[model samples]
Target: MVPFRSRVRCGASSLNMLKIAGAVVVLAGAAVFSQQVQAQAFPSHPIRMVVAYAPGGATDIVGRMLAQEMSADLGQTVVLENRAGGGTLVGTDSVRRSPADGYTLLFGTNAFVITPLLHDKPTYDPVKDFQPVSLTTVQSLGILVTPKLNLRTVQDLIAYAKANPGKVNFASSGNGSAQHLAGEAFRTAAKIEMVHVPYKGTGPAMTDLLAGRVDVMFSSLVGNTEHVNEGRLNLVATTGAKRNPATPNVPTVAESGLPGYEAGTWQAVLAPAGTPAPVVERLNAAIAKAAKSPRIVETLAAQGMEVRTSSPDALRDMLKKDSGEYQVLLKHTKTTLQ
Candidate 1:
């Protein structure tokens, strides 16, 4: 038999535990209610979209366009901030640390996933750290070579690379970018040896490629079509299963000699995890609406980007799919990066 005083103390202790549990439940309910209220009051101020690349790169160009359109639709200014470096890690990771409000967002590409996988200690987990808003667009990459190389066709480039071996140099936006993997795929498929030169971003890499400082780059044709028109860059092939409408004359890399070779990347918007569900829905709706706009569709089409908007869940599935695909590519090519 327990003492009467001991029983009383145990009863009081149980009562205190119940009080603590009740307080926790109340706090959780309050948090959920606050999120709902915040979502209702969202866009009361300017929202910022961080582009993880240089100003002139495809990601930045497309990001600015989407921001402009989404701003008009959301009745709030969507400011773009470029934070490029470490193969897109610097800017992308910065957004991961931002508050879980919809005010701060990330305009990211496939590189967003690939960049983290390259590091031994990844800065963030794509699945755990972000809430994907929606995919903005998709585009095929161009296998561009400097005209100074005098390479007019994929075959010519292959022959030159085979003959020159390690003397052939390939450039990419950064160490683990889609461009980097595409170049590696080309080298493997063509059975050639080419040194990789990585830049801080595609803009800097394009600058060097234009000046003949680099021999080749697998890049977007967004803002560089005039260079090819003026004979400054030779776009020998594209990396798409089908011919890109923007450059129908350019054959796919598979048709150019490397059979069964295809690679491309998509662009999407993401917010830090724990963003309000209502805010995510609002963002997805704006993206879907903007993607259907005639001006936005035409402009993206001109740049070779297919205007393909998706739900947040669809975008999340894409993230997982690309993560698996890139993992295979990285392993097959034996690609490593710091």
Candidate 2:
């Protein structure tokens, strides 16, 4: 026995609520559909891969190699952009600011983890600002000494370093480079003091090391292989967990004397944070495929690089682990950027 007016108002209210609910449901479904479409139709354009080093450098070479293969797999051009400076901070920041639409990616290295620890206040947060797509390569560093030094083994070098103390000099590509960290790690593990000399790049550092301007250097195995082969520079030991296949005669630092000592460089691809998960997965698959390609495997092997691709989650975990380890190394070495 309700009044006619009340009945009419209640009917209108119920109808309006039902209409609003229906609209919301439609909008939600549309949003999900839009995301699916976006994910399915991704990579409709070219991708820019930012390399955080100068052209002709190891990072640049590796990046270009991967880019060529990934370009084929993704059916899109993957362009290489070299943005060198700030110990890889410049290029990394550029990628960090880029849109999270999968068009821009950072071709990063172990320097990404080391440089931040060197700085008192890093410009970017390594863990929070980017999404790891894949790891490309891992190359060990060779402990190269001038033939004049006549250091034949890791123990010999450590003994000489201990006896010489501050007289021994170690050259690196830059202040906070991976090579620099490796040198520092060596200094710590060997419990010796050596003066650290920074250079513009590996080329310049290798030049000085060869010219006897510096007594020793923790150089890239690939970059200095010719010198090692020609006997121009003495390979004391390799800074890897095991001996390098290219130079099986050389012993690792761990085997030589310092157990549990391992230092090396690695490269990986990362996109800005907030990139779609589907797009990240797609990129990872392409990278994994490229790493497994025969041409790529042969090329990297020739350069003394081992092709090592990993899942995104695995890469993230590695980054976390390495960052912590680098923190300890930097502290022990007393290395500070600013």
Candidate 3:
């Protein structure tokens, strides 16, 4: 038989444990309720989207357009702010540290994964720190040749590069950029040797290409469409499975010579990780609606971008797929950023 004093002490401890368990259950319920309430009341104020690119650039322009569309859909002001620097690390890392609320978002691109993969020690983990809302744009790059080259098709460029070996120069906005990687991919597929000329941005690189300083470039047609229309630059081949609607006459690099070859950059919206599921769902639906808006569709289409909105899960999968593909290219090409 236990002593009466000891029995009393054990009974009291049991009671306290039960009390603590009851309190824990109550607190958990309260947390769930609070989260639901918060998610329901999301977007009660204006939202901010951080664009990790230079102001007045192609990404900025498209972000502004989508922001307006999202505003219409969410019935709240969606503001786009440019926060460019450190190869887009500055803006992106800031977003990762932001609250996991729907109010602040990151205008993410392929660089989101590619940039971190390039660094020896990444500041943040994209997959672990961010929640993808939706994929908004998928633009295929176009191959532009300077008028001095007189390269009419992908074949012509390949033939010339093969004959001249290391004489043909390919211009890119920067090292490890979509343009640079695409050029590397082309080099691999075509089995040709060409010198790579990397510039700080597309503006200067395109300037050089136009002045006959560089022979060719694999870039987008967003701001360069006018140059192509005016015959200042020769748009030879587009890097997509299908010809871009903006340049239907131009053939894809795959069809021209290298089959099963496609390379381009993409843009999407991402929230900080740990955001509420309901809030993520709401944002995804709104983005889908906004990207399909007639004005947004027309504007991006004219610039050679395809409006390809995707669900949150799909976007996550795309991030993984693109990461693998770009990793392969980086290894094969041995590209180093300056």
The candidate that wins on TM-score is 1
TM-score of candidate 3 to 2 decimals: 0.88
Residue-wise C-alpha lDDT for candidate 1, range 187-227, written one tens digit per residue = 88888999999987789999999999999999988888888
Q: Kindly provide the TM-score of model 1 when superposed on the true structure, using C-alpha atoms.
A: 0.92
- Report the lDDT tens digits of candidate 3 across residue range 229-326: 99999988999989998989989999997998998888899999999898999999898898878888887788899889898889889888888988
**lDDT score at residue 315, model 1, on the 0-100 scale:** 88
1 or 2: which has the higher TM-score?
1
lDDT of each: 0.89, 0.85, 0.85
Candidate 2: misplaced stretches above 4 Å? 1-31, 199-201
TM-score per candidate, chains pooled: 0.92, 0.86, 0.88
As a whole number from 0 to 100, the lDDT of residue 236 in candidate 1 is 94
Instruction: Please give the range of 10 consecutive residues that has the lowest summed lDDT in model 1.
Output: 296-305
Model 2 quality (TM-score): 0.86
The residue-by-residue lDDT of candidate 2 on 1-338, one tens digit each, is 56998999999999999999999999999977876787788899999999877665567777888999999999999999988777778888999999998999999888887777777765777888899999989988889999999989998898998888799999876777888888888888888998888765566677788899899998777656778889899998888888888888888999998999888999899999988888898999999999998987987686568999999889999989999988878878788763
- After TM-score superposition, what is the CA distance of residue 275 in candidate 2 from its true location, in Å? 1.4
Q: Cα deviation in Å at residue 236, candidate 1? A: 0.4
By summed lDDT, which 10 consecutive residues of candidate 2 come out lowest?
198-207
**RMSD of model 3 against the true structure:** 2.6
